[model samples]
Target chain A: MAAAARVFSEKGFGGASLEDVANEVGMLKGSLYNYIKSKEDLLFAVVRPDADELLMKARRLSGTDLPASEKLRQIARVHVEIIDRKLPYVSVYVQEIAGRGISQEWTDMDREYMSLIEKAFMEGVEAGIFADDLDVRVATRCFIGSLNWMTRWYEPGDPVRARAVADQLADVFLAGALARSRN
Target chain B: MAAAARVFSEKGFGGASLEDVANEVGMLKGSLYNYIKSKEDLLFAVVRPDADELLMKARRLSGTDLPASEKLRQIARVHVEIIDRKLPYVSVYVQEIAGRGISQEWTDMDREYMSLIEKAFMEGVEAGIFADDLDVRVATRCFIGSLNWMTRWYEPGDPVRARAVADQLADVFLAGALARSRN
Candidate 1:
């Protein structure tokens, strides 16, 4: 699956073939078919687990007893860590090639993930933690956009640097870059 | 050029043919070459002006005497406004298609625009307005990433809703969604 994920990220889901995945893993094509039924199945194998894990983690966080701000911080940290850990899968997931309709699973996962974040913001607004005037939907988009884009630029292997980025992102999302009470 | 921009955004630069662009404008392929030397030139024509304009406007804002926050606000407004006004153009410019073997013009424009924003954030940090701990480059990337992804989701028309989105994005970028203080 990891090999397939890298192939899909590089060649795109539609462009990647069963042979490509097999070659990636140094296996014969027939041998690969024993493990996966088809190319579409390979895509699902590579992408679904990542999405499921993200959705599960996000649900757990949103369902937590912690404050909204704290939840959001944890959510941001987890999001950054996930992207760092699964850059290949996440990159392929975000690309338009994945939207070509081999499976409805990706779309379903995306919509649910978005709604979960939206619900988090709505709860923040309700609890009077986030500003009342905050556009929860748009703010959710901003948050997701900022986090999702990490795959485009972030490189793994630097855990310290990656953690710093995640911390700063959570900080910016919570308190922003402007100093509190400007002089 | 507008037709070409739309075609490029939809089909991608490499995937799009001169014939497709020509057909988009309802022009004969032979006549299209009179205006453009090749497909790459068509891409440059469609994307370059928008990048140039953004850099020009951002440079103008950065050079102003306005505070960094105010400048950022205006820049954000203008950035969103530009994306709103030229969705098709902006969409194509940001796509990987534009990253293909185009002229150096697009590359230079992008760098200048990023440097301008980075400089603005650096100024804010220096003036003790933005947080001293801020990583200016990553922060600038965050800002650009937030603003750039708007092209993926923004719908044309409805100026009021679009303006609201722009304002909220700038607000979030500066102050975030959390209430004034930690409770």
Candidate 2:
């Protein structure tokens, strides 16, 4: 899966060949097919773990008895941690999900993951932990819009800086940068 | 350039070929080559106009003697308008810019465009229009983050809906959705 992710990241989903993955893994093309049905299936296998990891983390955090604000912070922290631990897989997931004419299964998985985040926002708003008037859908999108782009700039070894960025982003979404005293 | 944008948007920057653009424009590849040097050059041409349009619009609005609030509103409006007017080109730009091994010229152009946006945020902060504690760089990134993602979901010929979404985003960024009276 790691070999497949590197090839996919370099050549893109449409451009990558199964033979390249096989070469990287030091296996013949026929032997590679023994383990994976097809290139698309291989792509899915490479990305599925990262997606599962993200979903699992979100579920575990939501199961906690914390306030909505703390839940959001946990969500942010978990996301950063996942990206740090599985950088290449997460990178492939981010890049390939946006491609046109994606499979229905892929689209379904994308929406399912997004719905987890959306539910978190809705829960927060209802709990009065986040802004009451917040458009939960748009806020959810904004959260995704901010966090997904981090894959483009984040360096895995720099966990401290990544945490600082996550905290700043959480603050921006929660209280905003506006001076509270002025209000 | 418009034809090239369409081709690039439909079949990503790396996926698109000069022949495809030529076919779309009712010209031979040889004829297309007379106007542009390569696929990369054609992409640069398609993207450069929008950059110029955005920077020019920003400058015109900021150069106005209006108050900072109105200036910020105008900048947001211009950004939304660009998405409406040039959705395909903007989509191509966002998708292509994130991948591996882009040219230095392209990188410099991207930085230049980003700096233009950062300048507006800086001006707002210096004028005491935005919050003092607002990190101008992060604020600028947030704005771009919000605006750039619009291309993903915005439907063409739905200007009214687009405008509403844009206004809501502007409100979220400026006043936040925290029920301001309570705040």
Write one digit per residue (lDDT tens) for candidate 2, span A15-91.
67889899999999999978989987998899887787887888887778787667776787778777777777877
Off by over 4 Å in 2: A19-31, A63-65, A98-101, B26-31, B61-72, B98-101, B123-133, B177-183
Model 1 chain B scores worst on lDDT over the 10 consecutive residues at B94-103
- lDDT scores in order: 0.78, 0.73
State interface RMSD in Å for all models: 2.8, 2.9
Give the clashing residue pairs of candidate 2, or none: none
Residues A14-54 of candidate 1: C-alpha lDDT, one tens digit per residue: 55778988898999999997888887677777777777888
Q: Lowest summed-lDDT stretch of 10 residues in model 2 chain B?
A: B174-183
Tens digit of lDDT per residue, candidate 2, span B1-183?
999999888777766778999999999999987898998788878987887788688777767777655666667778788888889988877777632338886676666656766766676677776677776666556667777766766676667766777766666666553434453
Per DockQ, the best of the predicted structures is 1
